[model samples]
Each structure stands twice: as C-alpha cells, then as structure tokens.
Target: MSELGIHYRRGPATVTGSPRPRQGPHAGDRLPDTPAGLQRRVAGPGYHLLFGGPTRSWPQDPPLGGRGDLVSVHHLGTQSPWPGITHALVRPDGYVGYLARGTDLTGLRAYLDRWLPAR
Candidate 1:
C-alpha cells in the first residue's frame, strides 16, 4: 500500500527505520464507506467537511467565508468512523484532505488556504 501511495506515511528514517502507523485518518486515505447513506450526503462536485458530534457551537457561516462555495459542510454527529476526530475534510476524489483532532480551526484554515486558496 505504501508503494501505491494508499494510506502511506513517511516517518523519520532513523526512528524505527520504517513508516509508522498513525492514529485516526491521514491525508490521502480513502473515506470510510460506512454509516450508511454517507455517499449520498457527500455526493457533489466540491469538497465536503464532515463534523463529528453536535455542531451547535460551530460557526453558522462556512469557515472559508467567500470560498465556502468550494466546500460543503455536514454534521456527522456520533457516526464518525474515526473516534476523537472532530472533523474531516474530504476531497472531491473521496480521499481525506485533512483531519482535525479537536476544534482546531487554525489547522483547517491553513489546509484550505494551501489547497483551495481564495482569489
């Protein structure tokens, strides 16, 4: 899988001398096809932001502001496949673009800026 670039991770060459398994989903990993009807929810032309647990505390406006049109938000509640993950940004190709451990908007914003920079 590493050679194919599927669920592959490159760790320090000196540490363990090999790739180490990371917790939760990593970038480039395929989104889990579970919780039923998930494909339908994410069916679209742009990226999808899935949030775990209640999203009442999250800002009502899309995080990207004007660039929100490039990303659609969805609340997964407790149906998230990766436990403890607060959010997952799934790319249009069905692979994870980024993963957040908690309510880390700073990291997410950086990812969006890098990949989907605003005009």
Candidate 2:
C-alpha cells in the first residue's frame, strides 16, 4: 500500500464486513492500523473543499478558514501521490479535481472557477 501512496483519510474497515485486518506501514508511510482508521466514510453530499497541510501553516489565506465545507488532513504531503504539493480539490465523489504543487491559491481558485463558474 505504501508504494501505491493512496492514503485515505476515511476508508473501509474490512473487506466485505469481515474482521478487521492487520496492516503495517512502511517507512514514512504513516498509515493508521486500527479498523476505524481504515474504514472509508461515505462522503457527505455536496462540494467539499479539502486541503492537506499542517493546521495554521498558511496564515495568509484567511478566507480559507471561513468555509464550513472544507476538510483538512495534515499528513497529505507524505501520504498523497503528489508529494511536495500544497493543495488539492477533491470532488464530492472522491476524485482529485485539481492539484497545486505550491502555495498557488489563485491557480486553485481559477481551476475551481473553470469547473464551476460564478452562478
């Protein structure tokens, strides 16, 4: 799983309702081993803005804090397939719609606008 680098903030606990399976993380892959940690939660309906990084790491982005739909996972840099990138906007259905390699908030916003323009 480490090679795949597909870290799930929420995912399946077991295969088809079976008992919790054991998992071991390889070097630098800080994946959780507990059942609850593996369980994939059903994504809530609607557009959910997700960002990966340490909380309070970007103080300049003040508007980011006001969005109630935003989700933050601090370990994204190490867990995501796109390492060294700062932000990713995931669709509500759980696919990466946009990824920015640096602190380019404007690019991120433009990408979002392209998909969903002002209404």
Candidate 3:
C-alpha cells in the first residue's frame, strides 16, 4: 500500500499481533484466469481453486455445506500467479486464503479448516 502511495496509520500505535500480510492474492485482486476460464471454474457460488504443477487430483472437499459452496477446482499451468505454488484456495471475496508450493493436502486442509468456522 505504501508503495502505491496509499498510507494508513503507521508505527507501534497501529494494532499489533495480527498475522503477517500474505502476498498470494488480496481481497479485491482479480483471479489469474481468463474470463471464459474463470467462468467455467467459478460457475457456482464458492471459491475459485487453482493448482499449479502436474497434479490433476485435488483433495476431497472439506466439511463445507456443498461442493458448490466449498470450491470450484481448476488446474493452473504456467500462467499461475504464484509459479511455485501447487495449490491455492481463493475465497469468494477474492482473497487467497491458502497457498501451497508443494503437494500438502493435509496442511491445506488444516488451513482451510481454521477459517471455515469463522466464515
């Protein structure tokens, strides 16, 4: 934000102890997908999942309400926003909640589980 000339309250007086800001994707950032591709991926109401690398498989949907409300998985190729990441869970709000550089479904599950209850 600072680099973009958007400034906010700075220094120790600002609220502290929050988790470090992640760089994968911001709340309002665009999904790194073509219009048609994104249309196909997020055809329903849910997350727009993207995975890099040669993996065609995705983890089983977690305990969310329905597949449509959980995630719409897609295979991201070389055009991936985060080149090294194997998987990323883009929330409906457009923020990337989780990203994995390797095939770690368990870790991804844990990360998503931590946020599901809050949602």
Best by lDDT: 1
Models ranked on lDDT: 1, 3, 2
- Report the lDDT tens digits of candidate 2 across residue range 1-119: 45336644343210111121123222222223223532143155544343445544544443443343453333343444433435555555455454444554675555545555544
Q: Which pairs of residues collide in candidate 2?
A: 10-40, 11-39, 11-40, 12-39, 12-40, 13-39
The runs of at least 3 residues in candidate 1 whose Cα sits more than 4 Å from the true structure, single-residue gaps closed, are: 1-5, 8-24
How does residue 96 of candidate 1 score in lDDT? 72
Which stretches of candidate 2 lie above 4 Å from their native place? 1-42, 59-85
89, model 1: CA deviation in Å?
0.7
Q: Which residue pairs collide in model 1, if any? A: 53-77
Better of 2 and 3 by lDDT: 3
lDDT of 1 by residue, 1-87 (tens): 342256423411111111222454565666766677776788898989888756774667756846778899888877776664377
Worst 10-residue lDDT window for candidate 3 reads 11-20
Model 1 RMSD, rounded to 1 decimal:
6.2
Which predicted model would earn the best TM-score?
A: 1
Report how far residue 75 has shifted in candidate 2, in Å: 8.9
Provide the TM-score for each candidate, comma-separated: 0.75, 0.46, 0.54
Deviation of model 2 at 45, angstroms: 1.4
- The per-residue C-alpha lDDT of model 3 at residue 48 equals 65
TM-score of 3: 0.54
